[model samples]
Target: MGGFFSKLGLSCGIFCALVARFPLSAQTKQAQNPVIFADVPDLSMIRVGGNYYMSSTTMHMSPGVPIMKSTDLVNWRLVSYAYDTLASNDAMNLANGQSTYGRGSWASSLRFHNGTYYVSTFAQTSGRTHIYFTKNIEKGPWKAVSFKPSYHDHSLFFDDDGRVYLVYGGGKLRLVELTADASGVKPGTTEQVLIENAGAPAGPNTGLPAEGSQLFKIKGKYYLFNIVWPKGGMRTVVVHRADKLTGPYEGRVALQDLGVAQGGLIDTPDGQWYSYLFRDFGAVGRIPYLVPVTWADGWPVLGTGGKVPETLALPASKGLIPGLVASDDFSRRPGAPALPLVWQWNHNPDNALWSLTNRKGYLRLKTGRVDTSFVLARNTLTQRTIGPTCSGATALDVSQLKDGDFAGLALLQKRYGLVGVKRTKDTKSIVMVSAESEKPVEIQRVPLTQNKIYFKAECDFTDRKDVAVFFYSLDGKAWQKIGAPLKMAYTLPHFMGYRFGLFNYASKNAGGYADFDYFTISEQISKE
Candidate 1:
């Protein structure tokens, strides 16, 4: 990947100009909270030498457990994935009307020890916890290892004594030992309760009890971080400390600002330590925020005066676009890969159903089988739809589409809005469907004779007034509003932000395909 720019004939001056276009970190500029603003949740980060690598949870989306790299902690780019596929399950493949929207994989733990990188994630759909290890973290052929009985939000810790352990479980935190090879649990080793209710000294938890547990040994003292929701309160961060690995631990509240909790820690080479946490920003999924950590009296304290600062003594944000979101021409450069890392399939996609090289400059999405709904569609390419104000547009060719095929741009979520070309046995037509409140209902339709068309969806999330509008174009320059305003929402069923998706699904026939020429995004003035 390092040679990608060189293959594209980008000179040093051009590269420097491109770097200058990205966000600049001034000497006085402080890193803002929510460093990476996308649905990068359940984060577990580690610093390898001068480079920082973070593994995050992208549940149900194929190429799971995304590994991101950043020179500065603020700007990150997706480099690799721990697993290309989770498992062969009906829920994972969107079969039998079942989907693994929020339950495929959860809260991953990333670690680097003894010149090797390890990432552990649990999948409810497969009922197993997978451990992936690689010598080279960025470029890889990562090997997979899994065990039965998935532990909820577990942490993988390797101690100095050559002992490997898994610290896992919910309100009652438990610890179990693994074989030296990390194949499975060591038999006859007693699994002990590490912390009861995450040692919440307050009353019994009224909200979600202690969960999202991550353990770390800092300064030769064991420290564990967990997120708990108090009664009628936001998500809170709780930390516990102990001298021994498996002993009685003391606990306290670490942070409570906007529910940014539940990640491990990373330190700079210069010895500055910070806790990587995430907050649930509506419609954009869980966004990661960095908090400064200082040691006082042998305990790692978070933030200033128990409050999360808006800015930190680190690199400024690069605006979550360059790496996380991008405008693509669907054309591969001299040595470019077929697709950018920013794109992901809705679920485990049928590899044979999509291609970029098959058609020189267009993305060809072929339907593998018949589907009843969009949720059951097999190949839906998606990217994060950033908030405040943004719009995504795509031009699609429906000439090769068979009857009952719907191919177009969609704002995908539980309650989604779709503007696409729906082909019938006799004619082709453009339709707009909105799932603003109830199930999707068609709001408008336009009969089409041409085989190609352009579509766009604009989203506004300023002041939490989430809404989406759809538009269509006969010519690329002339656009027409075609649908009622969709009251966009962030629902738990999807458990994700609104994503701009290019989807092709067969409602009746099977071998239909669509060609997407390009996809572009533009940030607009806030509609607040």
Candidate 2:
């Protein structure tokens, strides 16, 4: 037995060393490079002084615009939200127990100029683009500016000569030079620079439809990085350059068929340039991908394929920035916040709705209005799906729930698949799972000895078909399984990845709250 153990240990060490010494391919290198944000789509990034700030499209989820801050181009933390409320009631009317993952915010832009941070969003349902500006990026006193730019995936860029321009519209690219005051478009500045009907071979689906336009000037040449949506296919990133800010620019392919391209240009101090792209992982929504840009013969070659590289040599190690950490301890440690980088709200959030106080050692979420749709409603605590094969666990104390009050942990993929635990007056507590059109299937119902409860849900993405497992605990140890594994698939129409977090709903008449503590996630590995 000792010989066997020693051999096994040696094998493991050899495997680890092999993995550590393996040379990353050019494609793998690009994919493994650390990015400040992950899984966030339609990114617009800007450099302010020495810090970098970024924002991405937040579909129906409230606290609409998520703002992140980082010193290096790699590590990022959620700093604040651009909008606190959904601003529209249509989002609140989604069918009860439905998932709305891929339908809300599309591509957005974040820019800093003249002591203000400007953000623009395309609300698909509204079909109108809106822009907001704030003097401070961290603590916003934001003001909304209205412009009926009937388009999606908009971006703003300021030229070297201090000229502002808006690039947007789909199927074609539009550029409108803005006046010096940044109030409106300059006279005769509107022009359609590139049309999808022009050059470029038709993809297996369809050729790229221009979108997500960001203008930049390098070496006196104007470059526009545009997001292209192939007909009936995934998103691609393409670039066009011109000698003049407004002109007949030449278009070249940057990234093709990698995923949806969002976010704009992000550069390191060492003069290395990378564009943050997004990949749609259904239920996981859109996650961030980094593509390194190198100029060759005066044209940009993204990744290494003249197309998006799936992998590449990792960024130079000297000035390397660490990737975002997925674990959370909830210790709060004086200055730490409770939420992680993946968490987002539909609208702006009020600090009073949450806290880490007393000896609770848990997240306390007060019950708010119970609206069927999460898109327009407030008081939802949610996070993005980080890994393909992972499990999330959280302990909840629901002793305070009233008759119609329910608090539980959920694995949500929009209005699609959901598995959770809820407390009721008659049942005490029950474990349930449901999908977009499927009925709420009860997995287990158990009477509670104490009002407080501990709950957990594990999502196993190891299998081709993702499986979700639910469990509950009374003392935070001895856990009991609630049901057979619930199977899920990413190929389902509108289905996305699973998001794990806590939520609560109160009857209009019942005033209640749900407290959650000790949330943790683990990566699954092969078992002997």
For each candidate, how many residue pairs have backbone atoms clashing (under 3 Å)?
0, 42
TM-score of 2: 0.77
Off by over 4 Å in 1: 1-28, 525-528
Question: How well does model 2 score by local distance difference test?
Answer: 0.61
TM-score of each: 0.92, 0.77
> What does candidate 1 score on TM?
0.92
Please give the distance, in angstroms, between residue 218's alpha carbon in candidate 2 and its true position after superposition: 1.5
Candidate 2, poorest ten consecutive residues by summed lDDT: 316-325
lDDT of 2 by residue, 1-528 (tens): 999999999999997787778744422323243242224666778777678788866666666778877775555777777776545544433434443445555567787777778887766555556677888888888777555554556667777778887777765666666676555557777566554432242344545566667767778987778766677666677677889766777776677755646445667766778777777654444566677788788887777665555543344322111122254545666666556545655334445666668445777777555644333334556665555555667776677776666567776653333334455665565555555344445555666767666776766553234666677778878877775666654533333345665676665433567777666766552232
* Clash pairs for candidate 1: none
lDDT per model vs. reference: 0.86, 0.61
Q: Against the hidden true structure, what lDDT does model 1 obtain?
A: 0.86
